[model samples]
Target: MKIDIQKDWGKIKSHFRTCNRRNMHVVISSVDSDQMPTVTPIGSLFLNDDQTGFYFEKFATKLRKSSEQNKNICVLAVNSRKWFWLKALFKGKFSDYPGVKLYGELGEKRDATPREYRAFQRRVQSTKRLKGYHYLWKDMAQIREIKFTKAEKINLGKMTKEL
Candidate 1:
């Protein structure tokens, strides 16, 4: 279904939050120079208020390369919460969408602002005690912005009829 990014921004952010809470990675799809499709899982995507978002660029070499060849990218964020799915299954309808597809064009790689950095840190603060947190995320200093063109609800036949 068509989604007004401005009007449904809150719902979009909520969906991302739900998925992020469960540590579900957002899948970014892009096509390479040779027209081969590539999908990359990213854990650091953050949505902003004005139809713009960014994701930390650490360890996303493939994504970066693909974006360079083709700026157009599609990001899929699914709420993988078991309870949410179970409730939907039981009720035969979803109160909200299970996932959304964001169509956008990748922007230039830039140094993340301190505010952005802090926000990322805050998102992962609960995992501070974990060793891998420091190794994997502490050094995330670069980011690539994305300006979304459209947002669409992922519709599954029969199952998502009421969404």
Candidate 2:
């Protein structure tokens, strides 16, 4: 289903937030020059209020390369919460979509703003006490922006009729 990005932006953000809260990785898809598709699991994608988003560019080498070759990208965020699925199954329908696909074009890579950096830090604060947190997330000082073009609700046949 086609979604008005401006009107339904809040829902889109909610979907991402739900997935992020569960520590689920958002999947980003891009095609290389040869038309082969590459999918990357990203944990740092953040949606802005104006239908644009950014992801910390620390270890996404393949994603960055593919995006440079082809700016078009599709991001998929699935709720994947057990309670959400169980409730939907019992009702035979979903109150909201289980997932959403965001179509967008990648923008330039730039140093992240202090606000953005702090936001990222806050998101991963719970893991700060772990040693890997510094090794993995400390250098995520750069970000790549994405200007969304469209939003599509992922339909699951009759399971999504109520949505």
Residue pairs with backbone atoms closer than 3 Å in model 2 (clashes): none
- How high is the CA lDDT of each candidate model? 0.89, 0.91
Q: What tens digits encode model 1's per-residue C-alpha lDDT throughout 1-163?
A: 7789889998998888888787558999999878999999998999999999999999988889888778999999888888988998898888888989999999999999999999999988888899999899878999999999999998976777776
Q: How well does each candidate superpose onto the true structure, as a TM-score? A: 0.94, 0.96
Q: Candidate 1: misplaced stretches above 4 Å?
A: none
lDDT by residue (tens digit), candidate 2, 20-82: 897558999999777899899999999999999999988888888888679999999988889
* Number of the top-ranking candidate, with lDDT as the measure: 2
